[model samples]
Target: MLSDTGYPGAVGSDTYDLIDRQLVHALQLAPRAAFSRLAAVLGVSDQTVARRYGRLRGAGAVRVLGLTDPERLGEARWQLRVRCAPDSAGAVAAALARREDTVWVSLNSGGTEISCTTRTPPERADHSLLLQHLPRTPSVLSVAAHCVLHTFFGGAQSLVAKSGALSAEQVAALAPDGPETAGSDSPVPELDATDRRLLGVLAVDGRAPLAELAAACGKSESTVRRRLEELTSSGALYFDLDVDWRIFGLRSHTCLWLNVVPSELAAAGEALAAHPEVAYACATTGPSNLHAVVITRGARELYTYLTTRVAALSGVQHVETAPTIRTVKGPGPLPLPSPRDI
Candidate 1:
């Protein structure tokens, strides 16, 4: 079985050394920064930075992914909660994981509940899997779809950046060049064919070399570089690092479904967003208007957080905690497990 660290039975492999943590934090700030740039910022040799990243990637502990902001693309993002027959939960989750539109698929609630996030383009909203296939599945007992209204945290934000592995100066030094001031009112740039092709390659590997991206998108390197800058600057595309939290000594992962007074929803969400334990938090349309993913050291720590920090939040009427049993997919594409592993 894969251990909590997402490594296959590697004892003590989850603990990242100081350099490793620093490197991760650096990448969290600038995911596509050249190795030489990262090394210089981290005060290490370029070879060392590259070697450490290679090791982390080979161990399945980290991945850099370039993802489009669904809101910028005028797409609807949904958080799906599916309750299934106990025996079919794993299979159902596996199916969801294989879908390109779905991410963060996990088994929860004693292997009978599945939670996932899916993006649906406006053109396909009526025909989405949430609207059609899941409701019709015999094994699915119920499906609750929550439309994400606003994100208080997550997306380009990384927990690694909050680790304090790098100093303020280091973070500033590695920051991408540009004035990123895109707001809700910023004009959404329409993506063309080349832009789509470029994003397709980056979706798999955010750090893919410029030459490779140019070839895949059928554009010159200079054009590809300029287009990438435009997309990022416009807040249409952002890079994220998918890493196992256990590497940071966080061994427990849970989803928090909270019902808060509508008047205080924004306040509560902003508060939760500030907590280090929260990996993702957003406002959604549902009985539980606020949802968050939290990471902690273990079950005991999770309990403490709920009893202390979470309990201290104002206007929370109800809270439901669903600890993840296993992740079927994360932010990046994940290989399906073998039948034996499943």
Candidate 2:
């Protein structure tokens, strides 16, 4: 089900027969969109949507994840591009996929190359380790990684149209079954400039203190608190975990880009995500169709992990690796109004 790198996918592989292309389609529209609402648009029952969504999450086909704004949040993110010996490259790619902090990995262009991503405290990890740690391995030939100053979703959901086209059942699915809803209307939160700024701050720094943020933004402590509450209540914000892979002792880092058979796409994706090293895997619209990020303690440990672990997975035809250089931001921030206007 896999092919050599740079082998044009147009040549046809069984990878396109995906199970829940709908899930990916939904995510591209609203990453955190409620499953109930999605059921309506997809013409499926609410519970079915929920169950399938759970399956998609389990399979790694649809990542309904959120990104924190790194800029205002006082953190940085980065990417690593690894070039390893062609023969040992798949082993290296598998090795890097195991880390918790690896955002994604991919083998692209050909088997000689790979790429890995991570989010970390800005400028903290030894840049040399980020670059040198993996390539130093016996199987590795060369490596390159760059700390990302900024990262943004390429808007994959827009690939699917009709965002608000939920079915009637789907609309009811969004309703909370509470006595208050019997007679009273559920409150919908409103956002203003301060609300937006407060969200922007948290988007970048989840740990930013309310008092400090208020002071920095020139608003009252209570006002900031209320704004935060309102925005979160409105579902305008979501939380996620962020860690530095190295400090977390997940030292071996690499990106894996895999080409799977069309018939095997769903199974291959599910298998990859189920692996502990396959921290984040996604079927994007691209070359190394399947991408993942993995982490390990060091080179020796990573080598064993790849060959003995990842190389054994079925439907995995080819793999490549790119050792990371460094991470400037993890998942930190999104755009905010100028002058820190909240």
Candidate 3:
């Protein structure tokens, strides 16, 4: 049965039950697992698992999506901070949310700044959003682009995995076969037209049925399944969940910019990645060499985290916190605007 709690906006008052959390964690381990398989691991009826997921998805509490890894494709990933006029931040964020390349579009710094991540292919470097579009926008006051150097966590790694709702045995049982990436010496795999079509379908729904994927990709079920495995094993594709953290009693979301000693940069990033509060952490080229997105229960928890956990780290000189005012986009693609809206 569904909970009696209301579907709160981004930060809500109600929390999901243990079963719900366990189910989410299970999915994080095996996103494309069959309903029967998930039920077996979760010790719940298949119908119950499906119903709970449906309810959560209907309430906009969770979403499952398939995403490409920019590194595997030899593309450039950027973290952008766009400072806009006070009155223009909302419009600027909405415009950015409409972009296919932009993800995690957020209004931060009291809604006067927009933070987002964008992926650029090699061919589009000359005409990318950072180099061309944002600079020409009249309402944009300034733009800071940080080239992502290395990700310590948060591509296929999900916070739910750290929730401890699932047992170690269950996690091992659901772990997918094959490594996520090839060695550096291995040649990068290219995505053909068929692979692109398959990925397009999965970008919307990672758990789409085999028959549905086969039809959409104009291939047989066997072929589609094989290709899916190939992409995942090659580290060219991954499944991610966009979950409303409020459902877990986490109400505060903030981005942290930190400058660490060059010698300890890698250690600092790895340490941040292990923190359950950190949703994403990476090393980037900028004045602030380390970047992380953290979520906490509320203002008090965020303060405590900064004072204790973050302050305890070594070689950390400074920290800048940009509280997210609103999030307009997540991990998935958004519907493109029509000519009239544009």
The most accurate candidate by TM-score is 1
Judged by lDDT against the true structure, how good is candidate 2?
0.50
- Lowest lDDT sum, 10 consecutive residues, model 3, at 1-10
**By lDDT, who's the top model here?**
1
TM-score for every candidate vs. truth?
0.94, 0.41, 0.92
Comparing 1 and 3 by TM-score, which wins? 1
RMSD of 1: 2.4
Q: Which model, 1 or 2, shows the larger TM-score? A: 1
Error of 2 at 266 (Å): 3.0
Tell me the lDDT of candidate 1: 0.85
**10 residues in a row with least lDDT, candidate 2:** 1-10
Runs off by more than 4 Å, candidate 3: 1-15, 178-186, 335-342
Question: lDDT tens digits, residues 44-103, model 3?
Answer: 999999998887766667778898988888888899999999999989988998888888
Q: What is each predicted model's overall lDDT from 0 to 1?
A: 0.85, 0.50, 0.84
What lDDT score goes with residue 89 in model 2? 69
**TM-score ranking from best to worst?**
1, 3, 2
User: 2 or 3, which is superior by TM-score?
Assistant: 3
Of the two candidates 1 and 3, the one with more favorable lDDT, higher being better, is: 1
What does candidate 1's lDDT look like per residue over 228-289, in tens digits?
Answer: 88898788998998887756777788999999999999999999999999999999999999
